[model samples]
Target chain A: MTTEFATRHLRRIRLVLWGVVTAVLLATGGALMMRSYLLPPTSEGISVEVATIGETDIRSEFTLMDHTGRAVTEADFTGRWQLVFFGFTHCPDICPTTLAYMASVLDLLGPDAERVVPLFITVDPARDTVPVMAEYVAAFHPRLVGLTGTEAQVAEAARNFRIWYERMDDENAPDGHMMAHAGHMYLMRPDGRFDDVFQEQDQSPQKMAGQVLARIQESQDVK
Target chain B: MRVLIVAALAVMLPLAAHAEVVVTDPWARASILASRPGAAYVTAESDEDDRLIGASTPIADRVMIHAIETDANGIGRMVHRKTLDLPAGEAVDFAPGGMHLMLMGLSEKLVEGTTFPLTLHFEAAGEVTVNVPVLGVAASRLDEGSK
Candidate 1:
C-alpha cells in the first residue's frame, strides 16, 4: 500500500511538471506573436518609410513652353498621366536613353499609352530651347513632350521635384559652356499630383511597363 | 510534391540564365538598338577596379571605347580612348555624364526589351560576354548603390 501510494504521488508530480512545461511553451509562443505584431521602428536604427518624402505636399509652378513653344503650365499635366524627366539637350546619352525608354514603354503599353503623357523638362534652358527640345525629343519618340522655361522657372520646377542642376564651365570645352544636370523621372498622376519616381539607373522597359500596369490597376481598384 | 518540384525549376531557370552577373546592388545594361548603330553602357563598380579595355558588339562595325570629360567649369566633353582599365577590381563606371562606351555606329537601332550580345574585353578578366538589355534612349545616367 505504501509503495502504491508513493507511485501515485510520483505520477501526480510528473503530471504537474508536464502541465507546467506545456503552459510555458504556449505562453512563449503568444509573447513572440505579440512582440512581432507590435514591432515599432527603433529610434537608433536607420529608419525608412514608403513615400516618406511627402514631396506631393509641394506643387511645382512652371511657366514654360512645350516642344512647339506653346505656352504650358502645370495644368497641362492634369487629366492625363505624365512622366517628367529632367535633363538637357546637350546630354547626348542620358537624355536620349531615357526618352527612348519612355518611347518603348509607350509602345509596349499600346493604346493605354495614350493616357500616359511623357514630358522632358530641360534644366539647360539656354541650349535646350523649345525648338531644340522638340527636335531632340523627336529623335526618340514623337509623342514625347519637351518643356523648357527660364532658368528661374526651371529651377523652381526642379526644386518642387527635389532635383538638382548646375552649370559647369569648361575652358577647354569645344563650345566653352557646360551643363551638369540632374537625371531622374517623376510620374505625375492625372490630377497633377506626384505619383511615382524612377531612378536614373536600374530600370527596363518591361519593368516600367509592369509598374505602370500594376499602378493603374491598383488605382482603378481604389477608385 | 509536384508543385514544389515545378516551383524549384522556375526559380532555377532564370538564375541559371543570369549566372554571369548578380547585379545585387545594381548594374547597368543597354539594349543593342536595332535598325541603326549600336551602343553599350556599364553599371560600374566604384570601389573595385575602374579600368575598361575594349568593348565589342556582334552587330556593330567596331566597339570604340570612350568617356565623357568634364572640365572644372562643368562642361562635359567626350574623349575617345583605347582602354579603360579597372585595377585590382576597382569599379570603373560607364554611365551618362561620366565614363561610358561610345558605341560608335550601330548596325541597327537598340529597341527596348531586346537583349543584345556584347563582349567586354577586360584588362584582367580576359573576355566576358554580357547580354545588354536596352532600357530607354534618353535614360542614360546610371548611378548604382545607395548614395
Candidate 2:
C-alpha cells in the first residue's frame, strides 16, 4: 500500500513537471513571436534592404519656356511632382533612352502619373527651339513637356539645377559639334525640392516608378 | 548519321569562320527632324582581332564614330574617333554616354518602330550590314520589346 501511494505521488510530480515545461516553452515561443511581429525593427543588428540616395536642396527659381512657348517656372510645376531630365533633341542615345524609361515608368504609374510632370529640359538651347522641343517631346509620352530658353535663360536654369553642359567643336565630328550634358534624371518633389537622382545603371521603369510612388507616400505621411 | 553530321559541321564552320566579327542589336534614336544628327549603337563581337574602321548608313549623308566622355569638371564632351579597337573574343558594346555612330545630315526623320539599314566596316570582317531599328528618343538600352 505504501509503495502504491509513493508511485502515485511520483506520477503526479512528473505530470506537474511536464506541465511546467510545456508552459515555459509556450511562453518563450509567444515572446519570440511577439518580438518579431509587435516590436519596431532595430537598426544596429539589421542590414538595410533598400538604399536610397541622400536628398539635396535644389534651387526652386528659374523661368524657362515650355514646348508650347509658354513661360514656366517652379510655380508651373508646383502641386505636382516633376521628373526632370536634361538633354537635347540631338542627343541620339542617352536622352531618348532615359525618356523612354521615364515614359514606361509613368505608364506603370497609371492614374498616379496624373499627379506627376515629366520635364525634358534641353541643355542645348541654341538648337532646341520651341518648335523643335515640341516636336521632340511629342515622340515620347504625351505628358512629357520639353523646356528650352535663350542661352542665358538656359544657363541660368542649368545653374539653378546644378547641371552642366558644353559645346563640342570637334572638326572631325559628323555633326560639326555636339552638346554634352549631365545624364542624371532628377526626381523633384511637389514642392520643387530635389528628392533623388537616378543614375544610368540603376535606372529602370519599374524601379523608378516604385521609388516615386514611395516618395509621394512618404511626403503624405509627413503631412 | 555520323557522316551527315560531319558534313553539316564542315559547311557551318567555314561560314562561321568567314564571318568572324558579328554585329548585333543595331539601333538608333529617332530624329525629331530630318537633316539633324542622330546616334546609333551596336554590339560588335569578334572571333578574331578586328577594328571598327567606320560605319555607313544611307539614311544619313555621312556617318562617323564618336565617343562621349565626361571631363574632370564633370561636363560631358564628344570626342571624334576614326576607328575603335575590337580585340578577339571581346564584345564591344556601343552604348549611350559612350562610343556611338553619329549619323549626320539625316535624309529623313527616323520614326520610332521603323527599321533602317546600317553597314559597319571592320578591318577583318570587311562590311557587315544590319537593320537599325529606331527607338524612342530617350531610350537608353534596347529592351526585348524594342528588339
Candidate 3:
C-alpha cells in the first residue's frame, strides 16, 4: 500500500514540474513575438552621435557614371545604405587594399549587411572605363559597384565629394599613364545625406564598421 | 614551384655573397597595418655596400618590397621594386606607406586573432624567420595621424 502511494506522488510531482516549464516557455515566446511586432528590427537598442558635415549653407549634387557608364544621380542611392569610396582602377595599391578592407568589414557585419551598399566612385574617370571598373571591382566582391564618368561629370562629382585626383605621366610607364587619387570612404544614410566620412589615412574598415555596428546594438548583442 | 625556387634563391643569394644579413624585427613586431604579411625591418650590412639584391618569403607565395607613390593630386599609387640596396650596416625599413613587403597569394587567410609564420631573405640576412601577428584592417600612412 505504501509503495503504490509513493509511486502516485512521484507522478504528480513530475506533472507539476512539466507544467511550470511549459508556462515559462509560453510566456517567453509570447514576449518575443510581441516585441517583434512592436518594433522595427533596427529601431531599438542602438544609439549614434552623428558627425555633422560642416557645409551648413550648401547642398551638393553629383552625376557619375556607374559600371554601365549610365549617368547616376544622387537619387540612385535612395532607400539603401551607401558605403562609398573615391578611387581609381589603376590605383594598384591603396585603393584596392582599402576597398578590400571595407569588403571584409561588410562581411563581418553579417545579417544587416544587406542594408549597406559598397560603392567605388573613381576619381580617374578618363582612364577608368566602365569595363575597367567592372573587372577591377569583380576581384573585391559581387556587390562592390564601381562608378566612373566623362571628365566633366567626374570633376563635378569629385568637387561635390571633395575628392582630389590627377594623372601622372610616367615616362618609363608600366602602362604609360596612371592616375593617383585620394583614399576616402563615405557612409551615406538611406536618405543620401553624408552620414560619415572615413579617410583612408584615418580609419580602417574594422573601425568604420565598428561605427556601423554600433548603430545596431541589440542585433550585435545577440551574438 | 616557382615561389619555392625564388624563396630558396632569396635565401641562398645572401649566403653566396658571404655576408651576414640580419633581420632585426624577426616577428615584425612593429607592423604597420599594425600587423600582417609580418612587417619586418631588415638591416643588411655588406662587405661591398651592395643593393637590396632581392627578397623572398616562404610563408608567402610572392613577396615583393613595395612603396606607395602619391602624386600632386594627392592620390596614392603602388610601385614594385626589383631590389633594395644596403650599404654596409645601413638598415632598410619595410614599413607601411613607405617600403613594405607585399605578401601575395597567401595559402590561407590567416586566423584573425593569430599571427602566422614568415621568412624574409635579404642580400646579407640569408634567411630570417618570423611570425607576424594578424591585425585589424590596415589604415594608411595618411591615416597614421588618426590612429
Specify the highest-DockQ model's number: 2
Per-prediction TM-score to the true structure, in the order listed:
0.51, 0.73, 0.50
Which lDDT tens digits does candidate 3 get at residues A62-125?
A: 7777786677887876777778777654343456557767777788788878888888876656
lDDT of 1 by residue, A72-149 (tens): 887866777888788765444555566777777888887788888888887767666777777677877889888998
Whole-model lDDT for model 3 versus the true structure?
0.57
Q: Cα lDDT of all candidates, in order?
A: 0.61, 0.75, 0.57
Which is the winner by TM-score between candidate 2 and candidate 3?
2
Decreasing TM-score order of the candidates: 2, 1, 3
- The candidate with the higher TM-score, 1 or 3, is 1
Report the number of backbone clashes for model 1: 52
Kindly provide the TM-score of model 3 when superposed on the true structure, using C-alpha atoms: 0.50
> Which is the better candidate, 2 or 3, if ranked by lDDT?
2
**Per-prediction backbone clash count:** 52, 8, 11
Candidate 1 lDDT by residue in tens digits, B1-147: 999999999988765443122121122334322222234566544233434567778666666565656557444445557776555434455655455554544666566556677777654445567777665444444332112
Model 1 segments beyond 4 Å from truth? Answer: A1-60, A171-182, B1-84, B88-98, B101-147
The CAPRI quality class of candidate 1 comes to incorrect
DockQ, candidate 2, vs. native dimer: 0.25
Model 1, position B116: C-alpha lDDT score: 70
**Best prediction by TM-score:** 2
